[model samples]
Target: MGEHAAVAAVDDPVTVDRIAANLRELGVEAGDTLLVHTSLSELGWVAGGPQAVVDALQRVVTADGTLVMPTHSTQYSDPSVWSNPPVPDDWIPQIRESMPPFRPELTPSRGMGAVAECFRDYPETVRSRHPLYSFAAWGADAESIVADHSFENAMGEASPLARVYDRDGSVLLLGADHASNTSLHLAEYRADLDTGRVTETAPVLRDDERTMVEWTDIEHDSGDFPQVGAAFEKAHPEAVRQDDVGTATAKLVDQPALVDFGAEWMSDHR
Candidate 1:
C-alpha cells in the first residue's frame, strides 16, 4: 500500500476512536445511563455518520450503561391531526429520506422519536398512555388528563410511565417544545391544549397505531406559541448548500452540553 493510503486509514480510525474516547471522558462510564439529543450533521462527517457515533458511544457505556435519544417522527403524524395544516405530500418523501432510521438499540431516542420503530423493543420504558399529555410527560395532573381521554384511563391502567414521571426520574423534554416534539402523548399536561379544545385535529390512524399524534402547547418553554429561530427554513442560495449538523459534530468536543443525563435521569424519568 502507498504510504498515503496507509496514513489515511490509520488516521481515520484514530479520529473515530478519539471521538469515542472523548465521550467516555465526559463522565460516560460503564454504569452511566445517557440520554442524548443530537444532530449528526452537527458533528461533521465522522467515519460513519450516525452508525459510527453509536458504535463509539456503545464502546464506552457498555451493557450496564443505557443510552437514550429521541427518535421522534413528528412528520409521520397524520395530516388530519395537525392543527395548522398539512405538510405538503410531495415534501414528505424528501423529509423521510433526511430522517435516519430509528435504531433504538443503537440510537435510542435520537431525533426524539422521529424514528419511532427503534424504541419498539422497549415500549414500556419509552411511552406515555394519555390520549393527550401522555408521551413521557411527568408530574402532571393525572385525574384531569385521564378523564378527558377516557381511552387514556384504559391505557394508563397499563401504563408504567405515569408514576415514573411523577417521580421526576423522567426526561419529559424532547428538547423541542410543542411544535417539534414527537412525544405528543404527553401534551395532556397542559389543560386546554390537552382537549383539542384549544386546537382541533381529526387525523386518522392506521389500525390502532397513530399515523399522527396531535399537540397544542400553549404553555411550554418554546416561547411565542409558533415562532422559533430554527422553524422557518430559509431559501438556500444556489451553489452548494451545507447543513449545520456536520459543523456541529466537530464542535461538540468544545461545547458544554445543553442537557446531561446523570443517575437522576432514571429516577426522574421512570
Candidate 2:
C-alpha cells in the first residue's frame, strides 16, 4: 500500500521473469561484492518467494563472491521508534519473528523473507562502524564510500542506520535512487573527521541484538529531510549518471531502474 514494489492486482509471472532477465543483463557475475536496498513488495510474487529472488541473484554473482542487502534490525525497546509506516503495526510482531539480527555464527539464509534473508548475518559488512561517520562504507573503493548525513535534533537517541548507509563496500540504490541513498553520508563524514565531534553510541536491535559503535548525525526532522536530500544529491551526481552501481554487499550489484526525483523537483520548483 506504500512505496514498495508489487505485481499489479493480478499476479504476474511475466514481470518476475523480466526482473530476472534484467538482473542478468546488468552484468551481475561471480565474486562481485554488492549491496542492495530494496522493497520486496516491488517484485510482486517472485518465483519461489523471497528465497527464489535471492537464488536468481546469487546465481548471477557466484563463486567466491558476496551479495549484501540491509538486514536492518533497528529494534527499538519502544515500538514507537519504528519507521516504515507502510508496514502494519500488527506486522511488527511477525517481522520480529521472521527476521533477526545478523547472527555471525549462523549461515546466511535466502528466501526466509526475501530481501532481508539475502543479507542474513551480513550486517557487519553492510552496517559498518566508523568513529566519525554513519552509513556503511561499503564498496570496493573505500575512497568513494561515504557515510555522515543525519537528521539534526530529532531523537533522544540515534539508530544504527543513522550512522551508515548499510553496505559493506561499493553502494547501490534499488527501491530508491541515489538521492535516497544513505551510503553517501560519507560526504558529510569528511566534515566530521575534522570536527572531532563524531562519537559512538549503542543501539538496540531486533531480537535483543545490541551494537556498540561510533556514529554522527544531524537531528532535524522533515525540516532536515529536505536539506539532507539536497546535500546528498549535490555530493553524488556521478552515482546517478550510471545504470549500475556496486555496493558494500558481499560484492554484489543490484541493477535497478533509476529515477531522479531531484530533477523532477528542479523542473517543478526552479
Candidate 3:
C-alpha cells in the first residue's frame, strides 16, 4: 500500500503511552537492540508527533537497550548520475565543488522520515561519519556501533549493520516493508554474488576541513529484497514476530537469522 493508504488504515488518535503499550505487546523488550524503519503517519495522528514516537521507543527500550535508524544524506551522492529531479548538465561541476561537507551534526537525512530525523537530533545520539549511508544510534552501545564506518565498505562487515548483527539485534518494521530494510545490504555484501562497484563522490571532513572525496563501493540492488524477506519469513517463522503498534502492523525479526538467510538467498538468486 502507498503511504497515504497506510495512514488511512488507522482512525483513532495515538499517544506516547499508547505507542509504548503497543510496543510491549509487539515483543519489543527492555534490553533488545532494535534497528527501526518507521512511518509515523501509519501510526495515525500522534499526540506529539515524531518526538512522542521517539519518547515512546526510548521509554520501552529503557536506558539499557539501543535504538538505531538510518540517517543517510543521499543528496551528498555524485551529481553526475543524478536522475530523480536531475540538475542541468552544467550545474554538475558546481554542485560537486560547492556541496557542503557531511557533518554528522549538520547534515539532515533526506527521506528517512520525521521520527528518524528527530532521533538523529537527540542529544545522546551518535551518528556515523559515512558521507552517504550514515546511521544514527542511541543508548548503551551507540558510540561503539557508529565509531568506525569504513568508506570502502558502506554496509559490509565493517559497518554498523554488522555490529548490530553481532549484538543479536532485532529489525523492527514499523509500518514499513523490506524495501527499507537496510540490514539486508550487509547480506548483499556477504553473498558470493558478483554485483558491480561504482565510484561515488561526496564532501567529507578531512583534517577539519571540507574536501570532496571519491571512493568506489559495491553497487547496491534491492530489487529482490521483498522476495528475500518473504523467503526469510517462510524459512524462520518462529523468529519473525508480528503485531500492531498503534494502527500500523509491525514486524520484528531476528537480524542475524535474516542476514544469514539473505546471504544464502542472494548467492542463488543474484
Off by over 4 Å in 1: 1-15, 76-221, 224-270
lDDT of 3 by residue, 172-251 (tens): 99989898899999999999987899988888988999887777899999889999999999989998999988888899
- For each candidate in the order shown, give its overall lDDT on alpha carbons: 0.33, 0.38, 0.91
Model 3, TM vs. native: 0.96
Mind giving the per-residue lDDT tens digits that candidate 1 earns over 1-270? 233443443424434476566664444556444434444433433555445655665566564444444333343333444456667777655554453332213333323432123332332233332322223211123222222332222222233323323322222121223244221223223222322223322232335443433444332233322332112112111211222222232111100011111112212332
> Candidate 3, after superposition: displacement of residue 237 in Å?
0.8
Our tally of clashes for model 1 stands at 45
Better of 2 and 3 by TM-score: 3
Supply the global lDDT for candidate 3.
Answer: 0.91
Tell me the deviation in Å of residue 118 in model 3.
Answer: 1.1
Specify the highest-lDDT model's number.
3
**Cα RMSD, each candidate:** 13.0, 10.2, 1.9
